[model samples]
Target: MAQLSADADAFGPMLTIEQAAERAAEHITAVAGSETVPLAAADGRVLAADIVAPVDLPPFANSAVDGYAVRFADLAAAGETRLLLSGRVAAGADAADVTTENRAVRVFTGAPMPAGADTVFMQEDVGLDAGAVILPAGLKRGANARPAGEDLPRGDTALAAGRRLRPQDLALLAALGLTKVAVRRRVRVAIFSTGDELNEPGTALPPAGIYDANRSLLRALVTHAGAEVVDLGILKDERESLVRRLREAAADCDLILTSGGVSTGEEDHVKAAVERAGELAFWRVAIKPGRPVAMGLVAGTPFIGLPGNPVAVFVTFAFVARTVIALLSGTQPVRLPGLPVRLGFAYKKKAGRREYVRVSLAPGPDGIAVARKHPRDGAGVLTSLTETDGLVELSDELTSVAEGTIAPFLAYEMLTG
Candidate 1:
């Protein structure tokens, strides 16, 4: 593993959230590789190139309903007009030619529109008597008939590059008569957790030892971000062991993620290991509950160190690590999706650091959805994440928020969806 030159000391103050995100974006780049896969396996993958439609969607003009196809000129305005029935056309069958002006053909839904027939009157709106159909008054031309290329045209872009394919996107490709597509390869991530007082579940606990929740949270988050995870488990607070694990991860994976040992504690070893192995790009971000977040490179592989607190780990990953993962997967980074929702309670904090409060939706006085803050504010409380619907973000310049004020809210799905 080779080390990059160190220039992180030149940056003086703790960086804002936006500044930290921009720095991470500048350092990371998309992997330059792609593979062709069948449509069945392309869901959740990023597209490598634009997909153009091979042919029109419908291929030909068709009937959109079960109706009688007739020439609009033969219908009268004040009274019903009679037309001789020529033939019937069902879906997936050939259309009948109605050459006579006063003739019509019985057509089912999705059936092809007959030749020389300008419009269709729904069967329920007309009458049939003695092998002849009576079209009602006020017949409109081209009614209930779907024209060719109405949904999609040939030679047009169907899906753009850098788009993460969803279930609906796969259906569109199938409709375009495509079985396979080119997609970026999945990103490989290596993750681990560090602390002396942390213990895995299903084990007897020592005095003052707590079970490790950060590892499980981090793993779930990485998987939800559409990346392949290489979980390295929990490492004890030892300098040499941390260095060895990081080196191995850098050699075998595209990026490294670790929780704990990056803060300014005397027992912290991960930060020093990062500085010795490579360059610690930045360690402190101006955000509450996750101010100890760190980003660096270990032997050219990007590394992000999240705080040990479960709430902090969740918040920092949603706002920061998610972008890095997207970049590594050959997709463009997305902004934190947020919308304005009314506040149901008052909140107060300092102006320099940003904060995210766990909140659930409640009914406001004006019948609009309002955000109600959770009672617990500790970073180590994992229930704050599980019980709340999402987070309410407060910017750096703002200090206090009164009841009924509008604030930005981020849903959990917006982070992973």
Candidate 2:
């Protein structure tokens, strides 16, 4: 991995969420969206290019159900027209011999319609005899016969580029007899936690110290968002160690993520390291619990340093880090899908920044009401995040929101696991 520049301040400004998003988008453009695989292997992957149907689906007129293929015109004068059974047609049968007029061909589901047959009448509507079957009333021409290219036309673009492969798309492609596909390559990402006091899970928690949770959270988050996560583990609060791990991460990973050690303090080696390797833009966001976010680059690798506080970690991960990841992955990322509800109590915030407040939506006289902050205020309180159902988004301009005020609450269920 390339060593981050020892001179950290040269990368650029500490970007806001919006600025980081733009840079991330630019970074994503550098990646080549080219990869090909089987249709069965393209699930959840973005299409590298448009997929044209190589052949018409079904490729020929076929039977839609178990019935007899017949010519509707031959039944004009009779209550039931008895016709000799020419042959039985089953799926995958290659027999293409044309059936003579007034002859009914026994056809099963998925069987290609014999040439010259214009209609199919259900078996239940036919009286089966030793050598022939009698077609009953209500039989119509062109009924239950699937026409050539009816499902899809030859050379038609069935799927467009930049679309994520879905289950139905896979099935459709499989039906077209396509064995492979082209897709956008996966985004490579690396994550590390910085703190001497932080310990990995399974280690004893000494007094005044805690196990590292942010890394686990981030790894889960990155994987869920469709990026591969390289675990860099926890780095002790040492500048030299931070630089080494960061450089290694930057060298191999397109995105390097770390939680903690970016704030303005002597121990904040992450900010210093990021500046030494790339650039750090500190964003003074209006959002509660996640105001301190660092967006920078390390050795040309985009470095996203989040807050050490657990609640802050969750907020920044969803709103800020997620957007960066999405942009890096060549997808347009937006805020969580929100559900409109009324605030149960009064709340206030300073203008010019967005706020995300942990809230528990309650049942009220009208409907679901948002109320009560999580018990803890420290950014380190992970329990506060788990206990809340969602976060109510408060715009910066609103100095105070009175009770019963309607607000947009982004449900935690929608944003987090």
Against the true structure, what is each candidate's TM-score? 0.91, 0.74
User: Which regions of candidate 1 fall more than 4 Å away from where they truly are?
Assistant: 1-6, 9-12, 71-82, 96-102, 127-141
Give one digit per residue, the lDDT tens place, for model 1 in 1-417: 223235776543587888876776666777777999999999889999999999988777888999898878777767888889988899989774445367888999998888878688898998889999888787678899888778888888999998989999999999888999999988888999899899999999999999988888888888888888998988999998888889899998888999999998989899999987777988888898798988888889898899988899998898788988887887776776578889988989888889999999977777667998889989988888889999888989889989988888999888765
Candidate 2, residues 123-218: lDDT per residue as tens digits?
887888899998887766799999989999999999987665769999999899989988878778888888888887897889888899898888
* Root-mean-square deviation of every model: 2.7, 5.3
Winner by TM-score: 1
lDDT of 1 at 279: 79
Return model 2's CA RMSD, one decimal: 5.3
Backbone clash count, each prediction separately: 0, 15
Among these predicted structures, which one has the highest lDDT? Answer: 1
Q: Cα lDDT of all candidates, in order?
A: 0.85, 0.76
